[model samples]
Target: MTACGLPRSGPTRGQIYSGSVEKGGSTHVVNVDDRVNRAANYSPAYGFGSDFQSAGQVGADEVRPGDVLGLSIWENVDDGLLTSMGASSTQLQQLQVDSQGYIFVPYAGKIMAAGNSPDELRRLITEKLSTQTPDPQVMVTRVAGDGATVSVLGKVHAQGVYPIERPTRKLSSMLSRAGGVSIEPEIAVITVKRGGNSGKVWLRDLYSNSRNDIALRPGDIILVEEDQRSFTALGALGGQTKVPLGNEQVNAIEAVAMVGGLQTSLADPKGVFVMREEPQSVARAVLGRNDIYGTQRMAYVLDLTKPDGMFLARDFVIRDSDTVYVTEAPMVQWTKTLNVILAPVNQIRTTEQGF
Candidate 1:
């Protein structure tokens, strides 16, 4: 009888399908102990609140074309040669840096002001006017300018190119200036591109971490992407769905719950598994094997029947692009046989007892 049947509560005999095993690649069997030890320690490049910092920043605010300057020149020494009737302060010159990068001045001809800061331009202008008047005072203010600009794209309210005229514009400030993120905080990934380098980070982290919210540099490209980090739940569950892990820094237990846990009666609790594709380096470190599984692609399993499995699930952090699979119990044969053998016997025994 024992050889002919197996209990419904226990996991049925497992088989490795031909398609499941490849000649060179095979899934390493993972159990509760492995999940608690190895899977719990698993970390990916973009997982576990990963910090991807900018390679470099735009050092300082630079003067560029299309910048408008408010120039106020003071010829304090009104020698009457330059001053026309008590003229001490020259009229404000709203000069816009032209395509040739030159701004015209009354006594100082066309002066190159594109590369120099307001202070530097002021000194340059004052020096040029020194021959004409003594102790010349010059003030250059960037009243209006697109000297520094950042390209903001993707899912944000005000998505466009914004000017960064002020010094030290932080990432959070820029995002706010661009009308904040479009959707929920959990579902957004902020990608920053600076010069030849680029990296991505969770918007949640950008909002929380001061280090990650670095200053925006001139020519920095910021993009707010929809959170793509998610785990797909398959097999005997309430529904087969992909649950988005908004900056997913959650554990296995939470992930399972979000995916609707299991289809209580249909799912075999002991057959719960997390399928991960680990990188070559991670796989090699986790498993002693240097095989293709070293590519951070590996399978991790958990048996809820175990007394400590539930506790271990809490520590097991699920990463991006992982698959949570729940295998169903093999109940059809057991149900049929139980009815066929026990039904008639129970009926006869009840009659014999005169119940």
Candidate 2:
């Protein structure tokens, strides 16, 4: 029977949990070092090096729908066969790129213009006209830009949609163009959404490491958000206020110090536990490792009583949504027992005095 209520007696739930765990119905217990090593090996799906989208993969000034271009074609003689074909006449006139990403040119019919830059279009047009006329000159000019735009919103000093006027301008440059993040930049979390998928990058990390400064694509939504990552502290510890994970990573020892260490007189220092559900990345990384707990949830315990336990705690890192629980000391439980037994005696004495 389990520790909860059951007819047959077997391994209690407590024994199963803290002692020999059942295969199907047990939470796995892992040492602090094993847990830390697994976490260290885990790489995030969306963060600094996420291969979501690359910048400058295409030209910034590349042609797109809703753009106007000036196309000109000429033969050796000023008013020759090219002039009669409507090529010379269309040079002075601007042609709008259609919604279907194409433009009509004399003799050439419809040309795919949305993916090619002005210079690229010019060279292509010249090659097409070479068969009809000798050394035909071609000119392509972009009159307007209606395709390259990005939106910057949330927690920024100024939130608005800005156009990426140049190919070299990227994600970081766009944030600067929007007047950058709010007064508290350190705690800002920037989210980039592109093509239905999104990823987050800490502003502090972006500022410190250039590698995190990825390129921006047109129609990309850049949102500056507050750092909402946090952890909870419970039992024999300070108030259960939610502690923010902040912009930078924090180790477990630092987390304990920040929340005020365990209640010295009442907490079992040796029974400190960090309870967490395994993240998919971490689970995948440690799945085949025999030394690691393969369960979905894990309770990483630290015995502060041992000198080396403090060292392990120092190296252990606290993750978001985790709970740092410090169990009560045995003496504290004994005190609670005495208080319950003394309550009746105190009440009886008070009633007698009242008579």
Top TM-score model = 2
Q: Score candidate 1 by TM-score against the native.
A: 0.69
TM-score of each: 0.69, 0.76
What is the per-residue lDDT of model 1 for residues 79-177, given as tens digits with 9 covering 90 to 100?
533567677876565688897788888788899988788888888988888987788887788877775788999999989988774433778888888
- The models' CA-based lDDT, in order, is 0.72, 0.71
lDDT of 2 at 182: 84
RMSD per prediction, one decimal?
Answer: 7.0, 5.8
Model 2: lDDT of residue 51: 65
